[model samples]
Target: MNHAHSWVHAFQDRLDLAPFGSAGLALFALALKFGYDDVASIGIDAVVDGPDDRSVDLVYVDRDQRLAVVAQSYVANTPKGQAKASKAATLRQALSYLIEVDLESLPERLWPAASDLRSALAEGAIDQLYVWFVHNCPSSRNVSNEIRTVGATVTSMIRAHFENSNIDIFADDISSEVLEQLYTDTNTPILVNDKISFITHTTLSFEEKEWQCVIAPIKLSDLKSLYTSHETRLFSANVRDFLGMKAGDSNINHQMQKTISENPQNFFIYNNGITLLTHGVDVFDVPNGKRIDAHGLSIVNGAQTTGTVGTSEIEPPADAFVLARFISTKSGDLIGDVVRYNNRQNAVTASDFRSTDSIQKQLVDQMKRIPNAEYDGGRRGGVSAAIKRRPNLLPSYSVGQALAAVHGDPTVAYNEKSAIWSKDALYSRYFNEQLTARHVVFCYGLLKAVENEKNELRKREHNHEKLTKADIAKLEFYRKRGAVLLLCAAIGECLETIADRVIANRFSLTFGEKDSPEDAAAYWQPTVKAISGLHAHLEKAFSDGLKNQEKVRETLKNFSQIVATLRAPFAEFFKSVENKLS
Candidate 1:
């Protein structure tokens, strides 16, 4: 009855964040929430946790989703039947302080995050704010009530903070069970494991390799029941969630519900049918038509239709029916495509369109040759590949961002992954014929190093480990937006010296054939230290997020002169880099 998620322990060990149990859970939940493939992929600087953190453990903003999350997490010292309900007090305090109060009054550590969130909310950059109480214990009604209070309080505060802003805020109790379900959604397309049979008077069947589909009519009542049972889990593989009916007459969910009420019999013709992906299916002809049994069900499409029916206040008419297609497949490689192609509701991003580009294919092939590393180039294998964590796995977005930073533009790399893959000029700059997997290892490894150092500094800060005054100043500098990528770009400027060789071509540089990013990151550390030593240069170049390329180049030139004057005291590490080169 009392057990811990193995994945939580995995996150702890992978990031080596043991003993910081609550922080580990926070990272775990955020990774799932954001579809981050590994602990390394997460930006640890988002953690605003410390004694002075004002009950805000983490604050993560997703501009793409128009969402901001303020989370308070707890990890039990011992296994318990349920998590403490009182943990919600932490979120309550956050709502009262961070949301309701002016940003100027916040503690220095929290002020930056609070300010970012405030700007997002007030400027209408964000429309959804989530307050999550995440813990590694079973959920209880007691805690659920507390979570509700937290949600209500945050909702009230949002209005007070942004009087005319249209932001919908929610509070969620992300207990261990809920966390597991979110994890399951990433690993598989379907989470509902119930085996159920369907009967229809008219039906058609089609077959293909490792897949088959049964087309039939499904009663609206039955469809609603399935949705009511699983909710968003039914659309686990869907590209987007049910974008509930908004304040407009043209909203699809609104139309679907109205059709069901005003024209029950015409529902099938007027509305698009649903597609259900399943683990297995068995079909047999009955006296009237066909009977089919399916297991492990999820709706790949028609989430809006199903959600509208499920959430409808009035019961769906018994006579109404919706056309349904049940597709059965066990192939992971193909299901990702199935999910991607079937989701017509969501806007396909530029990354999706670029996944098929000829350059991406070559990069994908080159990356696969390296051991203990995987790069999708563009497509990250969707739901199938996210089942497990690979700390060294370089997903498409990270690679794009890293390449963009080291090549030239830290601003694009830090903010425009879509633009990198979508824009022809930008795509060619990073993914041209001159680029190789080895070069990616070089740039990506340096970026990983930057991220790791930022995390290490914050870990020590949160753990209350002793830090010298200078070290604390360094941590503060690393906290700035685009700072890690900015530093990565800084280090890339001196790759030739750091490699301790006259490298003619920077794009061809690599840490060697077998070196993983984690190991290769060590070579970049001395450079990071050297450049970061000149805090004034860093502030001048990065204070506004690498806006002026000439200013950044001047900063690097100054850094180079300082290194030459010091004779580059990092000969020992530079020698290591020289030795590792293939």
Candidate 2:
């Protein structure tokens, strides 16, 4: 099958298994296209029946983008007149619903997604509300314009409700053609150059390995063209993203630009050369200088330099120079090593190198063995394997969070951005020997179960439809701070209880030791059963906490208090397990 067809088939399989059918699949496809690491369907219903979906079919909050996407799917196998009308009506209703609903009064189940929207709005992180009208059938220009009009109306309403928050509304009709394009995997071939001339050349040796380096002076205009043509994809293989230079700042970029404009001759000496990785390079004699034709040229370092040079306001001198290091290697593993070495030289964060660690490799292999578990270790191979094998599984970052949770620090896992992968204290905690593949899977299961329950609750709320004012008020209470963190803390408390029991019994099946992986695999069934039992109790605790509703929001806001609240109940539940073991 072609790439598009294969992706469609995979999505179909997921839809068959998923509770929120077409709408959920559309959301997932969109999430993948936008490079979101994790997404859960917050749709209200499985099927897009008539009206009454309350206009929003699915919602996804992306923290990285500080964006919340609310989508309404209109899938019609046969685009008859009635079907088209229904689709159009649904789209209009979705837009109206978004405008009319008070975010603070949303049902409790939606609070997870809504809380993100609220946070972004309050922080001014998000300025646009994207409402996608996803349709299986084709749409015309007239329909698109109508949708845009509705979007403008919603934008005005949102501004009014949000205290002139200046939130824009973008409405687009994603037709079948667009969906196919989104799913299609396109691999663009990189241009190959055999020999490229450099004004100056040098050699660097690291650990007995020699690297060929050269300084190349190219027109600043040509560099801008390359950047515009390739965009961010040019830096995909690099460890760090391009940090743009500020006008008033006296950073390295500013100094380099200054030298380029003032004395072009000194540009080569003042600037650190861009480090590049190529599959191979060939040398050829030319008139003024030699030609270096490189294959698969990627910038491994000097992103800031490139960004600064490309975006500089003043015209660069014709003779401005950029240092280039050409490393010729076709091996993917070697490319990663070269990138890591260059990034380390530049003082990049430890998180960038976590994927290369021995323990991470072992964990990736173990996760692959788990049924339905997909682990992308941020490598090209791992990412390809995940796309081909298990497209529905959460991304590597989510798996990292699970690792953090099981390793006994859900607080950091819940909050800190990118710290969980650090090689110092945080990384040590995550890869602690006590953590087994099974523990990771168990945590994964708990998260999935909780997400599933949240979806089901949304469905129930939608079906009931007649929520009283008091009912809405009570739910609003549960929607306050620390609600999701409370869930994480409860899981942590349960695991702590399990650890205490195992230590007291001095059982052969211990966790977090050197042999924990083997022990976890050996005792997989019992461990899963114990986790399942604990999960049931934890779910009850959550439900009870929601029902009590009195000061629960305040209690949940404090991490320690949330854990303390759950500790006794989890300890009591573990007592039965200990007795059974006896």
Candidate 3:
């Protein structure tokens, strides 16, 4: 069987285990193919019984795009006509229900995902909503038009509800033919200039192994076309991603776009040209100019320029020009060198170079050993595996936050900024062999406990319903501040009181030396008691802050001062506990 057929067979075998059958598998496969993470296959149909499912089968919220995608999958093994009709009916019902129902009123099984979608919509956290119909069978022409019409109706309803929101609906049929094409690696020839031509190559001859270079003036529109056709995969090999233009006026892409808009003819002079890596290239002479055909082309530099020009709302000028240098190499070793050389020209963050770090790998391995703890070092597969195995563990991004918090830099955690951890200076200090995965797991537990305490306190206060709106707002503020202060104070106390002994003994308070389940109960006993004692004092601190709301508010405004103010009290609290224990 071909690659496409193999995929189908594999999915077919797993259909019994899949809650939504083959459709769910197809959605998951599509999500994986597109590099989307954090995909949740919400089995709304299994729990809620109705005429049919009036809810989407899959929901994924893209934080980068600020978009929520709700997808319904239709997998059919029967005749095309019957499949098309069935898919159309399912699509129409799902869209209509989305338009008619308030998300908050959704059934309990669907409530969590629906609540997330609704929250994003209500808070303006998302800019767009994508309603997608994914299917394996081919859709008829009439059914296609029907799908578009239903989509339009739903879009109108959503727009009427949300004043400044955009909604787009898409129907994709993952037919055998389409899947075959997707799986096949076919290279197409590209036209560089009047005299230059580029063709893709799967293999290179011994004679063609020599490096060939070409310098040409390529049109901005052509570059944009390539970017549009390939999307992110075009720059997949590049070290840096296209950092899109920021909303304000501080970004380089913003400035470059402005310049291009103002002077189309002078863009070549204003912007640096892109450097590209290719597997093979051929040079030929033409009447007016030279022709260069290149294979396996990827932009090694100038991703920002290409991204801005291609995706910018303002169209690039017709007269705008960019210089393109094509370097051909057959050796994989040479390709690596080229990538490193080009990327090193610009300043890169420690996070960018983390993939090759030995410490990161060690940390990931250590984290995996922790019971019910998952770590993937932020890789795609790692993150997916971690989430699947231990959904309750902190997200991969929280690794850095936990690190900073435990390392006595709670200011960074309080401010919720990742810059300090991404920088070499601070990351090098804390992320070392000295800090084991056990330390991370312990710190994460403390943070989770504090979060749980805050939630319980909030729920208790809400149940009372005695506070005014202003007072309630003040209480919420205090709750957040109290959680951070308590967590930081607890981490400081743990380090001061226990870290040395634990390190010297090669033992953890949460897990003993053997890392056995039997030792966990004994290990966590005192730790739990310490946390409980700290919680009472933290509650008292919160109560005092609530009594002096104005003073707490002013103090909390400065994150540095808040950390400083909490330190002495936290220290005193720890000392009192130590004295009591003695």
- Candidate 1's residue-wise lDDT over 316-380, tens digit each? 87779899998888788778777866863322235666788787788778877776777776775
Candidate-wise lDDT, in order = 0.73, 0.50, 0.50
User: What TM-score against the true fold does each predicted structure earn?
Assistant: 0.85, 0.61, 0.52
- Scored by Cα lDDT, where does model 1 land? 0.73
Clash totals for all models, in order?
0, 14, 9
User: Candidate 1 or 3, higher lDDT?
Assistant: 1
Model 2 weakest lDDT span, ten residues long = 41-50
| Residue-level lDDT tens digits of model 2 in 154-174 | 666666766736444667666
lDDT of 3 by residue, 536-557 (tens): 3334334432234344333333
Could you say which candidate leads in lDDT?
A: 1
